[model samples]
Every structure is written in structure tokens, then in C-alpha cells.
Target chain A: MTAVRPPEADLVVADTAVQPSAPPVPPAATAVRPRARPRPAAPRRILMKGNEAMAEAAIRAGCDAYFGYPITPQAELLEWMARRMPEEGRAFVQAESELGAINMAYGAAAAGARVLVSSSSPGISLMAEAMSYMAGAEVPVVLINVMRGGPGLGSIGPSQADYFQAVKGHGHGDYRTPVLAPSSINEAVELVADAFELAERYRTPVMILVDGILGQAMEPVSASFRMPERRGAEWVLGGADGRPPRVVKSLHLKPEALEQHNLDLQAKFGRIEAREVRWAGERLDDADLVIVAYGTSARVARTAVARAREAGLAVGLFRPITLWPFPTAALADLAARVRGFLVVELSAGQMVEDVRLAVSGRRPVTFRGRMGGMVPTPGEVVDAIRELDGLAAGGSR
Target chain B: MERSVIFAGFGGQGILFAGKVLARAAMDEGLEVFWIPSYGPEMRGGTASSTVIIGDGPIGSPIVDQADAAVVLNPPSHAKYASHVAPGGLLVVNETLVLEPTGRTDITELRIPCTRLARDAGDDSLVSVVALGALVGRLRLVRVESARQAIRDTVGMKRPQVLAADLAAFASGYRVGSRTHGPSPDQEIVRTRVHHRVGVPR
Candidate 1:
């Protein structure tokens, strides 16, 4: 729950200086509540930060193990699973370094175990080379970048500054990877489950791009879930499948072979975009303004729409849960109904440019966002809504 | 229906644990619930608080900007959260810790010596539960049986000496609350925590 070692918690466990003893009360301290009135089982509930939710959703999506190094904003994901994954019969280990975690993810994915690696920007920078290796080898490992403010060791404040690194493909070569940008706790849960499926289908690395705000903010989520079942690893290069040995390695001195590999990867991404492109929509029907955003900024947009409605303005919201596939098709359709595109985010118009590319001048696209961990509020979005309405009055969106 | 309460106090007041127990009790009732705590600087002697939200509907926005009810353990909390309570909300304040009245006319408030109540019950650590008792008595949001079970689930019958005293302290709290006001909410928050008689993996 983004606990920074509260004083009360410290008092409860102050002796961590020494090794933590087995709990004073054994598991027996947890008593059994009788099933009264036989109601339907309660959905799981947790007051958890978004990063913890991502790790949990990863586990629920059949993550067999987690390979990660501790970093601010995202440290909770590792800490949560450290005690929890083993209880779920999964392996949770803190890698010696970000490089080690990324390589471990590569190995786990190659072995067909649902595996994940997560970090903030600085930590992610260290693993970019390994990420490329994973993509080059066609392994389906999920990597989460819970972004903090920065170009380097930015304070653990929220920022969408990693847009270029995530969507543009930070690693070398002409290869591309799929990225999912979840805006809310609910989407964070659903997107990771969907991400694992997409990764397996594409047989490529998938990035779940999250900001520090989403990483640290606590939200309510259903507590009980059955992780998706593990499936088809028949082709994984794990030495023996009782058949011919297939090795999974990223190595190519031959230019022709590497070019072919890139082509195959591109074909995979194209199929995914045509078939994928996940998004969340709101009040876009017969609207004069469409607010396009993702992650935490999108939530603020939702609140702004409510305020705009109260102010007698017609505004709708669109959140692209999947970033790489871009959801241009959905935005294009929304553009048909709305007067203009107002892209709001925590960075300097990264997603707004994508909105423009998608709308392709069919509608006027504009942006109002913050940088370096600053967040735009609902009032800011309301202003944008009013400005867009005024712009439409002049026969332009 | 969703019933949420915020528990706040200085460090060592067991307010956060109180919140967790409330959430756990709500869970035992087969209700969806969450226990969220405020993070303090990684140091000793820091103040802490937690918000536990229990509901039948999908709970939205875990951070409650305005609380329908609260259990405050310090004077500062009384000052901080007093105005944020919805009109006619239930307020359970620690008589031993909070020396001032919120002096609000619209809300129903019950003052109790929860710290003294817990200390008399042989565990000053249980003051949070004393506050919880008052909460349950005043609101009846959760069943009495559920409250008892929550206690047993949290600290079993093994400590038979404290078990009865803990239950009695809860009774004192509930009684104090009932004596102060009647149930006013249109819908009661029925909590349901899911647990196996034999332990299964959480």
C-alpha cells in the first residue's frame, strides 16, 4: 500500500535489525469465519498501490516467477510478491541487479514459464540491451516500467517521461515491441492479464508502461482471482520436449538472416495491431469534445468530464490501455463523433501527437499536459474542454 | 452497500492495526474490503493512520476525501477530520487522548476512554478494538457475531484470559455508542469475510 515504513509499523516490527522471527502467532492467529447465509464469495479486495496491483495481476495472469531489482516507486511490486508469490506456489527472487533480472526473465520466458521483470526508468535503462535480446529471441517476457520523474534517478514522483523509450522501441535494430499503458487500477489488473495472452500469442516481449503516480496510488481491486491457466510451451527451447532439440538464442552475424528476423517481428506486430489495440471509452457519443489520455492523466480526464457535464459542456473521454498498438482505429471512430481531440497527459504531448497521427487532420487535435512529475487536474481539462468548444464555434475542432 | 471508516492516531496507538482488523472482519462477513495505510517516513516515532473501506458494490477511489464516520485517537485528528465528516455521521473519539470536543451539532459523537478501557482489559494495545466496539454499537454496520468472530480470527480463544476481556471491551464500546445515538443510515453496510475453517492459502 506504498508504506514508507510508518512509525507504527516500525514499532510493530522494529526488530528487523535482527532477522525477522517467525510471526509471534503462527498461522493459527488467522481464525476461520463461518460461511454465514451462504452468500456468493466476495470479490478479492485490497488497498494496494498500482505497482503492487500490476505485480499481482501478473501473478494472476499465470506469472510463474518474478525477476526484479528493487527501485523506488516499483519496489512494492517486488516486496509484495516476496512474501506472496511463494504462498501462491510461484518463485519471487530479488535479482542481483537489473541486468540479472532481465536475463532471468529471458531464461524463464524461453522455458515457457510466465515470467516478468519490472523497474523504474534508471533501472530500466540498465536492462534495455537485455530487452532487445529478449525481443530478438522471440521470448514472451513481460517487463513493467513504473516510471518516476527523470532522464536519470528522477525523484520518485510520477511522470510519463518514458514515452519515447517505450513506444519508439528504446532498444537497437528495426524490431518493435508491444506496449500497454493502463490508466486505472481496474485497467491495470485487466491489462496485465491481457498482456500475458498477447505476449504468448506474439511470442515477443511486451511492456506494461506505468508512471510513478499509478505505481504509488492506492485503489480498490477485487481480491480473489484464478490466474489464467498455463498453456502451450510445446515449442519452448527447454532442452527436451521428448522431440528434436530447439535452441532459443539471439545471435546473428548474417545480415540477410537478421533482416528476415526483423521482417518476421514486424509481421507479428502488424497482426497484433490489427487484432489488438485495447482501449477504454467514456461519453464519446454525440460529443463536441473528446479528451484523449492514458494512465493517471486519463483518470483526471474522467473527473473533468463530470465537471464539464455539470458546467453544461458535452465532453467525452478515451483512454488507450494499449500504447504500442495505439488504438488509432478507436480514436478515429471517436473522432467521427466528437468535435476535436484534446490529449491530456503528464508529459509534453507525447500521446497527443499519436492522437493527431490517428485523427490525421479529420479533427483538430490539441494538448495540455504537465512534465517532470507534475499532473494536470480536472480543472485544467475543463479549461481545455471550454477552449475546444470555443474553437469548434469557429468551424474547427 | 459500502461502509468506510478512517482510523487515525499517533504512532503506537494501534489505529492501523485496528483498521486491518476491521477490514479482516468485513472480509470474514463475505464482504469485499480493503485496508489502506498512510506511509510515514522510514523512521521511528512517526504518526500513522489507515482507511478501511468495506462494501457490497465495487469500491471506487480508495482515498476517501470525506468520511461518513471516523474513530479518532488524537486531538489533532479531531481537528483535522471533524469538519470532513458527513452531516449526522458517527464520530468515536478517545476520551483519554482527545481532550477537546469537535463541538459539531449535526453529527452524533460518542466519547470513550478507549485507552483506559483496553488497559483495564489487560492490553493497552487493544484500545483500537475498544474504539471498534463503539463503532459497531453506534452504527451496527456489521453484525455482533461478525465482530466477535473477527476478534477470534485475529487473536484466537487460545488467550482465553484476554479473549473474554477483549469481547467485553468491545461490548462496552458498542453499548456506549448505542446509548449516544440511534442508527441513522438508510442502508447498513453488511460485511462478509471469506475464510476456511482449515487454513487455505490467502
Candidate 2:
């Protein structure tokens, strides 16, 4: 690893300082254009692995600095940043550890720079304390967790075991992080920009939760993105020239003051929950059963839904793009119409709890999950759906 | 239409690279593609494999339980993946490394001396490329021209000599693959011997 200066000394001016006064920005186009047209003006679609694509997307989204510690599955993202950040004249630091990396990110975000940090399961655990501090201090930072099998040092395979840890809160605080779960590489590329915007909008941490499969899989993605307008924030810890000093901290020793701060945070979270709920549904207009999943499991369940439809089963798919808000209202609406739900995940049962809560016993919410990094094949999931359909046909809900 | 293939070999045999080339070719053809590698503790000299799925519409799962085709470069891989091919699918085996014949008669098996062909093509490290050539040549899943363009795009313009050798190996394997009708006479004989020893009909 290359040595570098400390985080404090390496802080550069925010992205606005380096960018042109008014760079002509293109409109965002997330879909991959077909090659049949062969139009010279059209943006080209390039094949890229998910990790490399997310890194490039972050840079294009005007990320000013990146701090990370290399870990399996997601090490590629750090490696890409290490090479590209320097070329863009941005700060890139391979910190001594996950703790150091998160702190470095906290420092950069404090300086009003668009900051990003990424890791897998265990590394995220190490950064939990700093994440809580950042949330309490209300610093905007983007994090990517390419999840792998875990409890301890589990195998390096794709898993959704961290669903509860991420959306429910990984740190010890009454705080919520906006979590975006993308099912494909193209979506992941698009969500990287959204993560930054959401983090800055709410002045809190935002997470892009994915798994090893998305991190390693290669797919075609559009190479163009709309450049975000960067503006200086009044609360940034830049030297308060000609004014009273500004301090950024999370400590509130006084009991009433701490209670008030917690209440304010809860209000902010409530607003986010009302505004930022995102999800996708397919063939739910006239279906009795809907499969609810996200990330890799959603991808597989999509195929199962298609196969079930072909077999004359009225099966639909509901995928939660934002796992935090959980899309409770939408699911509850479906529960009134649909007979039941089948929640599939790579963990034994994490996201299913949220699905059950959404249904609230109005509909039978069954779960089919695989543990220890093993993903359920589409055939297996289809079989599970078939069995559920049979039970529903027998009025056994 | 959708098709999936598995490329399996030892870690140093460029298994992942081979799958990537096929995936790139499929993408260039405007087909949706997903390439996933088995990233585990298996390092150099250990088992390594990658799965590539191509479809006209959105691809669902990156993992494949039954593939339309498979290319196995070593005996261990053959033992593991030979039966994973769907019926009426194709199996490309590196006969130079995998000596035993796959006894199953359901799928079409093309036994090509991939290592020997790579050696004859001027570099022995091109074994994966050779296997890839045989797969595409026999299956025609992706156009040959698209595969060539994918190679150029992936190998880069900086390395001319390496590109030429890889193209040569691919061409050699393609020639052998297109010429073979079905199971070779030698494989038929081996199958007959095994069946007779086990008191089974051919």
C-alpha cells in the first residue's frame, strides 16, 4: 500500500472549487442504448463489472474524496478509486483500517466535500461507531456495502444477511440511514448518484446495499450521467473567516438537550419515511400471490414469477428498491387484494420480518430463505411458489 | 431466447477470462448478459469457474443450475460439471487434460485437445481461449465476428503479439470443433468397453 498524508492535511476544497464555472452537463440516460441505430451522437453502452461501474458513477456524480479499506468482494471498488481518483485530482486514501477509513470520510464530509466509503460485512461492522457519530453530527456521507456471508469470517459469497443490520440501524443510536438496494448493475449505477443526493439532502449517512453477486457480475451500463450542481454549504467547517467560529459535533451531555436532539432526529426520519419510499411491482393487478424480495433474491424471484405466469399461475413480484422505508403502505394495499406473499432472501430470515410487518396478518406471509451464502435457484423458488399457490387454492391461507 | 454456459478449470487456467470474453461478445451483439465467477478461497492451482448467461430479454439469476453448454478444462471440472448440462445441450471437454470419457449419452459432448491446440497455436497459456472457440464454433450462440471484436476490445491495442496468438488459437479450435460430427470413434470405443464391463447396452 502507498503511504499518504493524514486526512486533515489532505483536505481539498469542495468539488465546486475545482469544477468549471458552468460546465455543459448532459441529461441523465440510464437505459443502455441499442447498437442497431449506430447513431454517432448517441451515448455508448460499455460492459462493466458492478463494482467498477459504481466507482465510476460516484466519480461522475462529483465525489470529491474517497477513503476505504480493501475487503473481499468490494476490494475492486477501492482499487478502482485508487487509480481513478488521482487522475481526477481527488483525494483517495487506503486507510489503515475500517475505523480509520470511516473517520477519514467523516473528516472529508465535515469539510463539505462529497465523500464515499465502501466495504463488505465485517468492515462495515468496524465502522458502525463512527457512522453513529456522523449521523449524530449530521454529516452527509455515502457508503456502499457489498454484502457477503457472515456472522464471523464467513465465506466470500453473495448474501442478504445484512438486511436487518443495514435498514434497522447498525450503530447504537436512534438514527436511520437511507438504504437503497439495487437489483442490477445499471440500477446500481443510477443509485450511486441518488445516494449522494439523499445523504446531502437529509444531512445524514446513506447506504447502497448490494451483494457479492452484483459486485462481481458484469453487465452493460450507460456511460453518461447528469452532473450535479455543487454548492457551498453554510455549516461546513471551513475557517469561519470574518464570523464567529462554527463547531460540528454530536455530543450533548445535558439530559434535556440530548432528548430534544433525539426528538428532532426522529422528526427528520419521519419526514424521510413519508417522502423516500421506493419500490417496483409487476403483474399485481390480478394476482393472488406476490413474491417480495430485494437485491439478488429479487432478481431470481423475477424469473420465478415469469415461469409461474407461463404455467397459468397468477403470481406477481414486488421488489423494494429502498429497504429502509420498507414500502409498507404499498404492501399493505396489496395485502388487501393478494392472498399471500412469498419472501425470498439469501439469509435464513431477515427481510421477511419487515414483509410480515407490512402485511400485518391481513395476508399469509410465508418465507423461503437460504443461509450461509447459498442462493435459491429459480427452479427452487418456483417450486415454493407452486406449493403456496396450491395451498391458497385449497383455501388454506 | 436465453442460454447459459459454465467455464471451469484450475485457477491459473484463465477460466474467468474465458467467460468474460463470451459475455462481452454477447453484450456487443445487443443481448443481455451476466457473468459471475466463483470467487472463493480457491486460488492458484485450485478450482476456478465462471458462469455466463445470455438472453434477448432481462436476465434473471446470475447463478445457473443447468446450463445450455459447459467447457471443462480439467478432469476435476469434468467430474463436477459434466452432468450439469441440460439434455440436448453441448459439453466441450479438454481431452488433453481430461482423459476419461463422460459416459452420459444425453448431451452432445465435443472432446477437443484444447491444451495441445493451444501449444500448437504458439502459446500453451491460450487453453481457455481454445476452449472458448470450440464452444462458440459448435453452439453459434454468439456470432464469430462479435467474439473476435470482443477479443480485440478486451485484450487491448497495446499488445499486438499476444492478440495474434490468441486469434490463431481460437481459429484452430474453431476449425477442429466445426469439423467434428459427434462423439469421436475413440470415445465410442471407450464407451462400448465401459458398458460391456458393466453389462449394459450401448
Candidate 3:
């Protein structure tokens, strides 16, 4: 890893970050449960909001239980589930708090059920401890964070400021959770289904990070999914009736034991990084400038790119479908081919650091973004791209 | 061609519902559609607005800085969105609520007494449908037959009477729109490049 400055200078790094005592076990070997294939269903064209689509997608994925607290931008999701979960003969609970919701998720996941829990930024912060515990226990649960502005009871508007909070480890310990960000409603639906699949495959928690705008916007989507069965059934608590009782805990009393656990977690994460990286590249064959973005910001980047092309500028977009893996290799390759980079986002500059690290001094990378509920329009992105092009022209001369 | 429209009115004017109806109609016509509401505190008993984009291909942005057409239902809405209409674009004004004419002579402006027309049509709740009819009538952006079918699919099943009133109001507005002439230039100057699909790139 490159010597990069942490987002916060005084940030604390867990003591067990470096020590590894256990051998890496392959994820496939760890995953012994076979999932049921989803049968194709109808309702091929429906105009649904992003939040409602996510809720319906989860149901179609054969989610056994759903626990969530009502918060703006995502209130419709819980409401939809409350109306349909029971109809589908599944369990739905409106937990008293986000903390309660995630803990319930942990309980259901430990018992080997396809579980889903969702919340916004502030609510997500409340579940940090539970997330850490889930990560430590190696439980497979899917969480959806429809991000809004933040720092302290921020406005209920679209934002991506939680990038670091999601990818840089939300809770304590030296562990990472796979994070997927979707730019469109259809992509959000597909990613939510894949999140369950991935969580079970790695036997770890996975998060789908989306913005408030995407959650509130409506578009036409074809709802189709094959439900994923309860993962890790062989070793789950409830499924252990005939076998020895299985215990799930994250507390490692001894330093060596905890270090071994950390090493094993790192190995699983490494495998995920190598095998689960996903991204989309556009018009990169012969482009002088590339814009890096994810989630809703990528949509604006595409609009900006079209306008820039109309103005005779060679600009393309590199969107990371999987934010945790950061699509570092694809970015590095693009960095070598392009003249410079511009990272556009809805946060001050959280993800830009990752882009810079990925480029690793091979090319110059700049950033343009907004925060605290403000969104950058396509016109603004076009202006930023023009400025980057000017810098590239100046450097080449 | 891509058509970006803005519908603005008071909280209970059914502005959002009208946008949804248009989106459904566009979808039925096999066009790409994106609908986004101005989800702010103002939506509570205050002015409400939504942006709907219809295109022959995938839409890039759900929100637009300027709209190709603006349908204003109230005076405040007209004041807020009148200037946002693109040059040489179309502006549909509900004259019963917004009596003042937009001073811009560069674009085509259609004035319809939607509230009065709805009252005359026997259901005041059909004002938005009247405005919708006028919008579809003028632009022909989506087929009128498709919009009629969308109305049936959306609210027709629940309230057959409301659907009947809405069809009558739509027919009145369509007549007014057909004879009123089309937008002056009939196209927006800022064209959206249609090479890339929404999330899936071709």
C-alpha cells in the first residue's frame, strides 16, 4: 500500500491490524450451503421508485426476514415491506431503533436465515457496534444504507459522505466489509440481490450504499430474482439440532486468538478483493481525461461527458460498482492511458483519496464535489472537466 | 429526442400524480422515463413540483437544470418555473390560477383554464388531468391514446368515476392543445447525447 494520509490524522488504528496467526481458508471451501436458483417471474415493466423497488427486490430474493426503522428517503421501503412481508409469509419488524433493528438482523443471520436490515446515515452510526460484532462473528447479513447528508443530524437530502464510513471499516477491529454502490434504480435492484449472494459466499456482512436521490426517484424496472436460501446452514445455530451446538461470538480473550481471527478475516477479504471487483468503463479507448465516480454521481458524470464530447473534449467515466475493492486496477490502467483524472462526488473529497492512491503518482488526479445535502449538477461537472483539460494541456506543453 | 418537463403546483394539486401518469404513458409508448419529485419540507402543505424526463433512449440525469417544457398549475409555480423553460421551448399555463402572462416572447405559451374546465367537467380534482391533456395535445410527445390507457391503468381501477371525469377533461384539453399550435421552434437547443444507456452501456 502507498504511504497515504488517513482521512483524519488522529484516527485510531486497531492494535491487531498487523498481526496474523491463522492460515487463509478459501471462501468456497467455507461455504457448504447450496442456494436455490431464482425462477423467472413476470411484471417485466413497472414504474417504481428506487426505495419501493429495493424492497420488492428483497422480497423476490426470498428474504426470510426484514428489520428496519423509518427514516426519510427510506421510509417507503419499510412501509412497502410492512405491507408485503406478511403477505409473502415472511417476517417484518419495525424495530424501536436502528440498534435494535441490526441486532435483530444478527440474531436471524446467526440462525441461518436470509436477513435484510436497512437505515440511513445517523441510524447506521447507531448500528456500528452491531456491525463490528457481525463482522467478527463472520455472519452473512445484507444491510442497505440509503445515505443522506451528515456529521450531526444532517439534512435529509442525497449525499455520499459515508464513503469512508462504509469502506474504511464502520466499526472497531481490523476488518473490511464489501461495499457496493449503484447508480440507477435497475442497478440498485440487481446489486441488492447480488449483495445477499456475496454475503453468503464470503460468510460476511455486505452493504449496498445508495444516495437519497436514488431512493426517492422513480424509473421503469423489470423485477425478477431467484431467492437465495439461508446460507451456512450446516453450521448455523438453529440448524445444529442434531449436531453439536454452534456458538457465534466475536470476543477473543487472548491476544494470539484474536490475532489469528484477524488474519483469517484478512485472508477472506483478500479473496473477495481478487474475485469480486466490479466496475464499468465508457469510451476509454482514446480519451485524454477520465472522471471517477460512483452511485448517483456517476449519472451526472455521464451527462457531463456527453456535453464535453459535444464541445470536442475527450472525456470518459469510470464508475465503481464495488466501492470496497475500489476498482483500483482498472483505475490504475486508465490513469496510465489518460492524461489526468477528476474525481466527482457528493462529499467534500472522501473517495478522491482512494482514487489518488490507486493512480499512485502515475497521473495527476483532481476532485470536485458537494456536501451537506447539496448536489453537483451536470453543468458543474462539465466545468470541472474543462478545468482538468486545461491543466492537462498546460502540463503537456 | 429527449423531452424534459417540470410540473409545479400547490401541495394538493396532484402535481406529482400527474407526473407519474405522464411517466407511465411514456413507458407504455416504449420510451425511457425518469420521474423525480422535489422531496423537501415544502411538500408539506406548500408548493410541490416534480421533474419527468421522456426519451427514445436511456436517460442520463433524473434532474435537469432547465426544462424543455414547464406546466405550471399555480401562480407561485409559474413565477418559480417560468424562467426555467428553455429558449424556444413550450410553457403551459393554468390561466384560472395564474392570470399573468409570461413576458418571454421567445417560446410558445399555451394558456388553459384547467381549474374551470375541471369544474365544468364535474370534478374539480381533474384539473391536473386537464393540464396533462393540454401538454400531450401540444407536444404529441406521447400518443394521446397511450396516455388514455395509462390513466386507466393508474387510477381507473380504483375510481371508475374519477377516471371517467379525467377522460372527459383530457378530451377538452386535447382539443384546446391541438388547435393552439405547437412550440415555436419545436425542439430544445441543448441536445442530450443518446449513445450511452442509463446504467448499461451499449
Best by TM-score: 2
Local distance difference test, candidate 3: 0.80
User: In terms of docking quality, how is candidate 2 classified?
Assistant: acceptable
Clashes of each: 12, 0, 2
Candidate 3 displacement at residue A275 in angstroms: 0.4
Between prediction 2 and prediction 3, the one with superior lDDT is 2
- Please identify model 3 stretches exceeding 4 Å from their true place: A1-43, A229-232, B182-202
Q: For candidate 2, state the interface root-mean-square deviation in angstroms to 1 decimal.
A: 6.4
DockQ values, each candidate: 0.08, 0.28, 0.22
Clashes of 3: 2
All models: lDDT?
0.71, 0.83, 0.80
lDDT score for candidate 2 against the true structure: 0.83
Best by lDDT: 2
For candidate 1, the docking band is: incorrect
Question: In terms of DockQ, which candidate is stronger, 1 or 2?
Answer: 2
lDDT of 3 by residue, A255-350 (tens): 999999999999999999998888876666667899998888987787787778779998887888898877898788777778999999999999
Q: Which stretches of candidate 2 lie over 4 Å from their true place?
A: A1-43, B184-202
Best by DockQ: 2
Summarize candidate 1's per-residue lDDT along A1-397 as a digit string, tens digits: 3323211111111111111111111111122233464345434344456777777777666789899999887888888778668877888879899999998888888877888889999999999998788888899888889987886876676778888889887788776788988765655777687678778888889899988766765555543333565677666977765688887877977999878877887888789878776776666654678888877777667667766877998787777877887888777876777778788877877777788988999888888988776677567778988888887767651
DockQ of 1: 0.08
Q: What is the lDDT of residue A19 in candidate 3?
A: 12
Candidate 2 lDDT tens digits, A64-127:
9999999989988999999889978999999999999999999999999999999999999999
